[model samples]
Target: MQSSHVDITKKSAYVDAHIHLDTYSGAAQAAIIQLLEDDTLPLDYVVAVSMGLKSSQATQAWARRYPQRVLPAYGFHPEQALPTDAEVAELLAWMDVHQAEMAAVGEVGLPYYEREAAAKQGNVFSREPYVELLEQFVQRAAAWNKPIVLHAVYDDAPLVCDLLERHNVRKAHFHWFKGDADTVERMAANGYFISFTPDITYEEDIQALARRYPITQVMTETDGPWPFEGEFTGTVTVPTMVRDVAAYWARLQRITEQEAAVLLRENARCCYGY
Candidate 1:
């Protein structure tokens, strides 16, 4: 595979702590490839998160293509149907086998948005099975000593927090986090990190969280391939947007964009050890 020409000499190097590049279309994926080769884009490293087995495999391919620029994280997403134990074991074993190339075990957590969908289907969504699944991943993270990226948010955040505590996993990053004050405070106290997406630019609650949470524990993410609203609406989600998100955090925290950018970038590398 050819090495990426993404320049790291730029004033500020940004790290996208969470993005699902495999979820993008062929053209979008090609665009990223071109960006990496052009040396104009201001992206330093991207942590590509997986939704399932196939996503993880595709992510690994990208990581291989851009060894220095792309970091891969593998795990199951919460909103999807829970995989059986055998399937879950297969995925975890695959991740472990590729642990030498893996950045983390991630994109895992409880389903916070499945209730309404379950109601429409005339079936109740059970949390127990998902909890069991999450426990398995958490155990793997602990055993491997790799940071775990989380999809847990809102009311569901506390449950995931409990599991993390039970497993004694300290290196956890809660991407696009949206939860209560108590949960946020506990997470902060426990030394867990939280990152904001482009939504922070217009979302009052996310802005508030940015101000309340210590900047030392904050990071930035595009959650790319995941659309956004407000100013980000109609824009293709990309790592470049993390620059603007850092600026927003700067204003909210009363710091310069350069300072915010550096801190956030370091936070990413610190959490994922990339």
Candidate 2:
């Protein structure tokens, strides 16, 4: 592997566009701190995504502890059942009040995986509630003028794109994205951003995505605490892994590692306004 020209000794040129920092254990977090201090890990910042209101609060705490490195985004994830309307309202209110502190409205999207689970059980469920909840978050993102990190994949991505269009929310990021070519082209045409995970190394599908999307519209992430396979197997997911991911992306895009690092960092800044 070619050594990265991104000199983390002077300054960080890479960013983890999406992660759930609140979910990591204390010891793991300490390891991250040590790596950063030793300049072994060269990441500028991480966009910490929330699962729900409680997770949002904890993520905010992490942000406070690492004020310069951890950026918080509060929202509900779709993997779990939707919260009550009142609870949703409370979450929105919390986000609104802390808009100044947060970076984006994120980790919110339709339950694609849950839908698959329901089908395996011979159950059919409506996505209306998910759409409705996403609408609320989109509206908040618009009102707050904050970028939104989405988990929408495959067929659901089109619907998510519809809502973004309806709401006219332009600064959107689909993290760890997996979708059809048509949808990918649609998103690229709309100038939407996408972030790739470490899977880019071994997953040909993800490699194709990196090849198809313009470098300027791409970023990198570990989605840490969520393990990966390939070269990432068995190792605890950490932000430092992004260095290798960026290098792989550079190879795929036929650009130098430094160029890829700078482009990814700029993409993160543009998406999250950091």
For residues 251-271, what per-residue lDDT tens digits would candidate 1 score against the true structure?
887766776777777777778
- The model with the greatest lDDT is 2
> What lDDT score goes with residue 207 in model 2?
91
**lDDT (C-alpha, whole model) for all candidates:** 0.85, 0.86
TM-score of each: 0.92, 0.93
| Shift of residue 71 alpha carbon in model 1, Å | 0.6
Q: Candidate 2 clashing pairs?
A: none
Error of 1 at 18 (Å): 0.5
Compared to the true structure, candidate 2 yields what TM-score?
0.93
- Give the runs in model 2 whose Cα sits over 4 Å from its true position: 1-12, 36-40
Worst 10 residues of 1 by lDDT: 1-10
